[model samples]
Target: MSYISRLGSAFSKSSMFASEFFLDLYMYAHYCGISPFQDRRNKTYYKLIIETHAIEKGLSLANPRMLFGRKKITEIMKAARRYGIGSNDLPILMATGALQDYLALHRSAGLSDPLLDSIDAFLKDRATASAVLGSGGLRHYPDGMPSPSPEKAALLTSRFSCRMFSPEPLDAETVKEIVRIAQTAPSQCNRQATKIHFYSNRERIGQLLALQAGSAGFAETVTGLVVVAFDLAAWGGAQQRNQGYVDASLFAMNLMLAAHAMGAASCPLNLAVPHSTERQIKIVGEIPKDQRLVMMIALGRPADGPLKSAASPRRTIDEILTIRDQAVAAA
Candidate 1:
């Protein structure tokens, strides 16, 4: 390539970077929580999401906290009313039913809290609860792996994103073994940039989870937390700008599967945060600034005996996969 042609290419790439930088600035200014220009409807939608998450987490935790659900149930109902309840309200309704079950069980044992009465009264007249509770609600099933089959497909389908974990702490060597398996994940140019920060200390895990509010109730039960990250310094140039995230994510998936295979229940927590929150997490976790975080995985054994989990349905393969050969020919 000619020197002038290379210069022109460089200039074009710089211009593209400038444009993307401005676009990112615009998004950060208007779409994030601190943005004054954020849409009010979006705020309401997020509030509903927060309440829904609290409800789901409360029910899915190994130790059910009726009081925790009690604290958010009213807010959930209010938000549901404001947002115009729909099928999305099903999880909230199901959580409320689970809380009711706990309350009933407590009463049968000659134990009751004042809050339980108010909770019962509120649910008695709740239109949203009446709408979905009986027809479609969360159901608990017996816990055990599928009947022995040598089929690989059966094993793949058996994996679940477990929220509740047993109290026993995971040993460091066991965690290292999982990472050893995850190390086989493909990386760009054999860079092997993926890194994990393991936190087994109860207090440290609590601090990390507090920074990530989504895992509020279940954080206490987590035996360990792993922060998946990749070194951006290993990348060469513009073409490799997003390779870190891609590689780190692949490693994370492998790590989860490996943990599951080793009798560990793992839940991937979102780390897609604003710059400020990301910085705070780095400081608290003592992670190097150059390491870009992909996500956090909560790891531990599932609770012993019968337990419940979210039956989050998946989309059909036809809905997700597409064949573009015909489109290419038409073009």
Candidate 2:
């Protein structure tokens, strides 16, 4: 769904169909609205050809399965975090595949569904910020620069979300470095209720990777993973749902940034396995069955990938910040 200058501008409309099959599909989708001479046979060909190409292309687009299966989902997620589409696409792809969903949603609904949205949500600063945050990226100003010396700016600036990685083992000391950094992350009232388990041994790594893959990475990448746990007893008293996540996430970001500083690339993966799967990982890691699993981290040296994976797309500043009523009053 990319477009160049239209006919009579740069390339002729006729020229597009000759380029790539996707381009051909684009041309046909466009022509469907204009051309009267087009027949059912031509339309059918466009449908069939585009559907075939889209599915194959989608698989190659950013599949983590190419690396290994759930055994390496962290690798897949590192790539996905860099490209947000990977996370969003998986469940959908898992549910309906690429083409079938596209046809039902886009083709049948046609161009209308895409362009029809008001796009107001996309235009909002908060919405844009949330999108970036959810995608594991930090939001920024419009001109592609961060506000001078803001929180998380350094972390976000140094992060590239990684595209590829080596199938190598994480050095024990390297794991220690990451653990040290994460342990320093602030906790509620200095509760310091978090603990980390480093698993690189093939036997243990295999179990953890399995839990991760069934959850959707298709494979676990690299040699080790860091399992972050928060003691339920740490927060004590009544704890809100958001508190658990917030405390964990704050610490998680600290760890990720620290990984980069220590000359390693890391991605935050999930523990989305079934209860049984999670139980297996905890036992293999010998966590004593008392602490709750907060999150997991995959770490290693990054691999070479398409485009270097450094160019991060971001929202405009005006698209991410706004003054609250109290803040505005203070101003």
Candidate 3:
């Protein structure tokens, strides 16, 4: 090619690349939750999730401050009242339960405060009233950790996304074991950013699954829901921005395999929503803001009787494999 022609082509390519980059920035600004364009409902819902999680985290602390998170409880009440969030909503219900647990814990210790009265009033208010759906606040683990199960060779090929599940919930021991196996998945620099939030409450599971798009027909049958996420704090620099997803995906695959090995069925649900929706999920799931969601896994004991699943045909080995041999051919 002529020198002038080459120069012109290079310039055109650079201009196109710059334009595309700016377009990406524009889209991100318009849609990201941090931007002003975020939906009002999502913002209100996100606030509730964050406040409730704060209470939960405080309760989980080994040495919690006396009467801590009073402001957070107030914020939760305000958001719930403003948005009309009811007990039927998992996030609100969890917030109420966490507050109740907080009050009970403090009262038992013979500590009394006006903030407790405020929390009590908030709980009794009809506008924000919600039954504390299931056990919330702090999760109590069994005394000892369960040992990991032996690896089954057939699990890889035999396992598929299970759509139908029995009414039985997954046992806590088995769930812990599955997570123990999944924790073995490789991570970037061994940061171990991946975290799983398991939900076994049928009503809460239904509420969570409702936010997901792919669980339409079989959501009712799902007895366990697992939200797989990776901590953003584990990654730094522009090059590592997307690394969280890669690591979390690896962890999620391992988790599914582990479930299958444990004789439980699991189906992965996609979380390809806007930034606003993601924020809402993080809040509702009681996940930390530093974590980014990868996907959700609906799991449980397989239903009895014959079951059907997608064929999910695969490409041929020849189509997928590409053994480049340019050096050999040149030689």
Candidate 4:
């Protein structure tokens, strides 16, 4: 081609990228951060899940067959109710019902704990409680229940986000091994740009978690924090800007699964704070400005005993799937 033609083509490409970059920035402002109204339904939906998960976190400890943490459980239920009432969400109703049943069943089984009175009081508002706790709340198991089967399926299904970690320090080498396994996660264009900053120091983890906004009861107990970040330098243009988050998230999931496999528990800490919080996190975490934060995974040994995790129900495959093979023929 002629020199003038080549120069014109290059200019066209650069102009297109510049426009795309500004468009993405506009979207980031509106859709990405600290927006109160964005995805309100989903926001409250997960809030319900968080509150319900708090129960599982405590119940799944090594065996005592008795109720514990009355005040904490009551607080979790209260939070769930508040979020549920605000949203009037069906899934939240279902979860609340299941939790009520779980608590009721334990109380009936002579599991001695003072929380029964509180549970009864909460249930006294039968109208509100029954509205959410539809007919089938949850399944109950007598004292000794076996792990869910097909070992791999159990590994996937049984894994829970542990809130409480043992006070004992986690081994650094174990953390390294989990990350090594997680490194196998694929990245767009094989860029493999994900970086993890592991914080084993208690004070530093607390500082980072403070900026994180959540992690109230468990942050101090977290033996380690994995700050997952992806390098912007790995991508070329605006078209690939969001790919950093996508790739880093995949790596983060792998790291969590690897931690579970190695008998270490992990809780994913959301890093979706305001820009000011992000700036603070950058300083506390020592993350470079060029590296975008994905999320933090709180890792450590689970507190010893019968561990109870939230049986966060999964929607059936059909609920989420859409088959469109016939549409191609019509088009």
Off by over 4 Å in 4: 1-90, 98-150, 326-331
Q: Once superposed on the true structure, which residue ranges of model 1 sit more than 4 Å away at CA?
A: 1-13, 24-50, 69-72, 78-141, 144-149, 236-240, 315-331
Instruction: Please give the distance, in angstroms, between residue 221's alpha carbon in candidate 1 and its true position after superposition.
Output: 2.9
What root-mean-square deviation over C-alphas does model 1 reach? Answer: 5.3
Q: Residue 34 lDDT in model 4?
A: 44
lDDT for 306 in candidate 1 is 69
Q: After superposition on all CA atoms, how large is the RMSD of candidate 4?
A: 6.4
From the highest lDDT down, the ranking of the candidates is 3, 1, 4, 2
Worst 10 residues of 1 by lDDT: 132-141
Candidate 1: C-alpha lDDT: 0.71
Better of 1 and 3 by TM-score: 1
lDDT of each: 0.71, 0.50, 0.75, 0.71
- Residue 248 lDDT, candidate 1, scale 0-100: 91
Task: Write model 4 residue lDDT over 29-70, tens digit each, in one string.
Answer: 776534674686565556555556555544443342356555
lDDT of 2 at 39: 72
TM-score, each model? 0.69, 0.50, 0.54, 0.69
Error of 4 at 134 (Å): 6.0
Judging by TM-score, tell me the better candidate of 2 and 4. 4
Candidate 3 clashes between residue pairs 3 or more apart in a chain or in different chains: none
